[model samples]
Target chain A: DTAVSQTPKYLVTQMGNDKSIKCEQNLGHDTMYWYKQDSKKFLKIMFSYNNKELIINETVPNRFSPKSPDKAHLNLHINSLELGDSAVYFCASSQDLDGADTQYFGPGTRLTVL
Target chain B: DQQVKQNSPSLSVQEGRISILNCDYTNSMFDYFLWYKKYPAEGPTFLISISSIKDKNEDGRFTVFLNKSAKHLSLHIVPSQPGDSAVYFCAASGFFQGAQKLVFGQGTRLTINP
Candidate 1:
């Protein structure tokens, strides 16, 4: 079974549209994160949440927001999606907010903003 | 600025040979390092990690070496198998929030030949 799963593995949307990508982890992790992999294949962290609280928010555009209704789920909601958002968004989780623990990852949600 | 860097864009190795992937970091504060492998269309899967306190970490055929003085780290796969062919990323986080926010390298595509 996949430890982390994201809904709608591939999303294609038009510009200025608002959409949300959902993520869930069955590993019973306390921390979750969202990362963006751009066309150059550079993966960068966008956000991190622990116990439903935001911990790290990279200098991303204000149009992007993340919501954690509970510990098991973290959803990325993009408002007025832009062409720059056309990349893969990944959801990851770790057992703790420590450097030593392993971070398991979901398959990925490839968002294509047209 | 890109903190973690994978100088080689790709590496190829013969089956049963050794595959060496190198990474460099500019941040002096980074104390924890990790290696993640990823297949196309999938999120990264954690392979192994090392802390600034240690110089090397090994798991099965995978080994990670860290050289603080050089601000460098590397992942070595011995007896490389075809299944090991994938994109590998190097990440680093410092003595802060559980490596909560990781800075990743561009990524190295490893192709293992039969």
Candidate 2:
């Protein structure tokens, strides 16, 4: 069984279009996170939520937003997507807000903005 | 600024040989560190972790060594196999903005040749 899963595994769209990626975890974790992996293979954290409350927000652009409906789910929405936004986005979860805990990651959603 | 860094972009090792991956960090406050492995088209999987309090932790064929004085850590895989070929990322967790967050490295691609 998949502990963490994401939808829209591959997305291709034109610039200026908006898109949303969904994530879910069956591990019943308390904390969820959104990370983006750029072309150079740099994985950077964008947002983190604990128990449905926003906890960590990085220096990401205002066009990107993360929403966690519940502890099992965290979704990312991008507005006016740019070519720079073409990267693999990953969803992860941990047992708690502790960063030391092992975070399980989803398969990832590859977003491509033409 | 990038707090975590992996100097090597790639490493090649033969099967039955040992593979070593190195990482460095600029932040002294990081109390915990982790290693992650990612194959193509898959999300990163937690490999091993070490607490700054200790110097080394070993599990199965994988061992992690930490040198807090030099702010360096390394992952050694004994008897490397083809299945072990993947991208390795080093991450550090520490208090930042009143919360604990993980800072990831640029990642090192490990290739085990048969």
Candidate 3:
């Protein structure tokens, strides 16, 4: 069974366009996170939600927002997309907020802002 | 500043041989570390992990070694096979803003030649 899944494996859009990526996990995890992998292959955390509440925001631009409808779902919405936003976005989940918990990652969405 | 670093961008190994990947971290607050493997067009899958208290952890063909004093870690794979070829990422975990956060390195691609 797929533990974590993301929709739209690939996304292409123009500058100033708005886009959203959806994620879901069946692992019954309490914490979920969004990460971005840039052209340099540096994967950095952008946001984290615990039990549907915002917990970590890693100084990402205000144009990016994350929403969690429930414990199993977390979605990312990017407004006014820029070329620098072209990267792979990954969603992850862990059993809890414990620092030692193992995180399961989604297949990732390749976002290309032209 | 990059917290986690994997200096090698790629590594090649012969099948049935051993493969070793190294990682370094600058943060002393990190107490947990993990290794993940990712193939093209796929998300990263958890390989192994080690706690700061432990010097080493092994699971089947995969073993992870941690050195808290030097803030360095390494992953060793024995009897490497062609299937083991992929991009390997090292991640450090810590608690921030009451949430667990992961800092990932720029991955190192491994190619196992049969």
TM-score of each model, paired residue for residue: 0.96, 0.98, 0.98
Write the candidate numbers in order of decreasing DockQ: 3, 2, 1
DockQ-superior candidate, 1 or 3: 3
Q: Scored by CA lDDT, what does every candidate get? A: 0.92, 0.95, 0.95
Give lDDT tens digits, candidate 2, residues B1-114: 889999999999999999999999999999999999999999999999999999999999999999998999999999899999999999999988988899899999999999
- DockQ for candidate 3, C-alpha atoms: 0.87
Cα deviation at B99, candidate 3, in Å, is: 3.0
Better structure of 1 and 3 per lDDT: 3
Better of 2 and 3 by TM-score: 2
Give the runs in model 1 whose Cα sits over 4 Å from its true position: B95-99
**Residues A1-114 of candidate 3: C-alpha lDDT, one tens digit per residue:** 789999989999999999999999999999999999999999999998999999999999999999999999999999999999999999999998887888899999999999
What would the per-residue lDDT of candidate 2 be over residues A1-114, giving only the tens digit for each residue? 899999989999999999999999999899999999999888999999999999888989999989888899999999999999999999999999876799999989999999
Q: After superposition, how far is residue B18 of candidate 1 from its true place, in Å?
A: 0.8
Docking class of 1: medium
Per-model RMSD to reference: 1.4, 0.8, 0.9
What lDDT, from 0 to 1, does candidate 1 have? 0.92
